[model samples]
Target: MATIKDVARAAGVSTATVSRVLNDHPSVTAESRERVLAAVERLAYHPNAAARTLRSADVTTLGLVIGDVLNPFFTELARAVEDEARAHGYYVITGNADEDPRRQDEYLDILLEQRVAGLLLCPTDRVSPLVEEVVRRGRPIVLIDRSIDGLDLPVVRSDNATATRELVDHLVALGHRRIAIISGPTSLVTGRERLAAFRAALAAHGLEVADRDVRIGDFQTASGVAAMGELMERPDPPTAVFAADNLMALGALRWVRDRGLRPGSDIGLASFDDLPWFEFVDPPITAVRQQTEEMGRAAVRELIALLNGRPARSRTLPCQLVIRGSCGERQGAQ
Candidate 1:
């Protein structure tokens, strides 16, 4: 069988450059790419997908690494990225980081070893090393959802603080003075900013933020369940709770059900990231909607531009707060 080395020799280019040309990578120059493709055709060479994917893998693909895929926010983001990538003649390989830095590092290393055309990451704070490694290896990367501090990579994100603050204002207007917050891991920029906004919202209203009113955990349903449990255990628990992510919201709902407590009526709930089942529940939970699909599309567009030798701004898309029954506030009832 004809191999990448054979193609490289025929094209008089490095194996890596030949691989890039084969994948139709946007980063490769037209003249050099043409030579490689011509050599590939002349040699009648075909890539062994499994082996090629490791070092000589020259496929048109984007590598996406996220903190949590099970979370609706990330899942939706992945879908958006995939859709946009395919439109540009590229496929995506996704991996979950589980909000752990070590896992993030491992995935990035693996992706680079595969010679991916580009990569997108939702990094933990521990992401700096990985970011540096990608840069060192000359990989084009776009950070998504969370920016890796101290790195100069292109970033695509939603305005987390603004959305959370708006949600708090809406809750306060509903005559709920005690609004508790359940947030995700603080290592990521989004989680930290959103949590800060929750506190700032309380401060903005001249309301005291009790330490007990906050719970920190991974954005998993189990964490939300645990946080809600802690909140309910308090002598003077909050009347309204804000679960920061869809998975946490689900957890909060489950705990609300487990304790036989009414969600919308007994303890008002507002969540971020609306899911399909939101309306089907007894009372639909309100949410701060992040434009995951649009965000993904925009990110891919920027990445493609970067690949094509165009400059791209680090983007932060806006969020829309979707009001529903869970916040104990009827819409348009001013």
Candidate 2:
């Protein structure tokens, strides 16, 4: 079947441009419209009827596309979104992107085909053209946990910069000068922000951030393990390590244990996300606690406002730094 993507490719334009031409949007240039129409005819493209019906019907269902279902952060977020949606007398359909851009795009298409009234997405590093088309059509789309550059969409997420600064400060206070970080992929706003904040925090304390001290991971456990191993194998290994997310942090902890190294005594450890299990670990991990439930509920509320033809605003929720035994205290002065 000839999808909108096919038509756009044939026309040498973006899907959003193709959509505008097809819908007779006034902003589309005559030449561009002619080109899109010709491409549509050549490809025998047919717009999905379900997409057309979405605007006309009152759908009480919203589509939620999360980055990774396996991550505890996203798992809790999904539950919160589901609960909040149900409370509003609406149901939700969720799709796991697994941090893959292709998978994310596929899910977006499937949700739109299912005639979802609105969408709440935890996008991958890159933005999907289909999402842009949906927004151009004036259908509601809210960003959850992550934001894309150049997209003015309503987003609900944590204040990563402040939280990261606090985490670094806590680590520095523990007298750790050789600090390393296992960061998520920089394509994501959260990853970029946290990494930048970590560097800034280090500089504020007269510490230089060495290139070798930074290890990029995919926000997965395996990557965490690999990154930690690499950092530890260095000639001058860091005395403290920070993992950007909970799953990676778990991986870091596993690596520490596999090498017979204790967390607080041999080396310090901390993470960006604070999961319930963090407190139960052998040496409870220090972490930044984001209000996942509030983030989910706020995303739903923003989406609902858009559905009701009201303006929706982006929201940044605060995060708390949970101090624990993972990063042991410095020698007593008190």
- Candidate 2 Cα deviation (angstroms), residue 290: 0.3
True-structure lDDT of candidate 1: 0.85
TM-score of each: 0.83, 0.82
**Tens digits of per-residue lDDT for model 1, 120-169:** 88886645677797888767788888886677878898898888888899
Q: Could you tell me the TM-score of candidate 2?
A: 0.82
Local accuracy of candidate 2 as per-residue lDDT tens digits, 1-334? 9999999999999999998887778998888899999999999899986666655566778999998999989999999999999999889999999999889999999998888889999998756788788878877899999998998889999999999998888889889998999999999998899999999999999998899999999998999999999999978999999999998999999999999999999889999999988889878888999999999999999998988899889999999999888987633321
Off by over 4 Å in 2: 1-56, 330-334
Residue 183, model 2: lDDT of 93
RMSD of 1: 6.1
lDDT values, one for every candidate: 0.85, 0.91
Highest-lDDT candidate: 2
TM-score winner among the candidates?
A: 1
Clashes of 2: 0
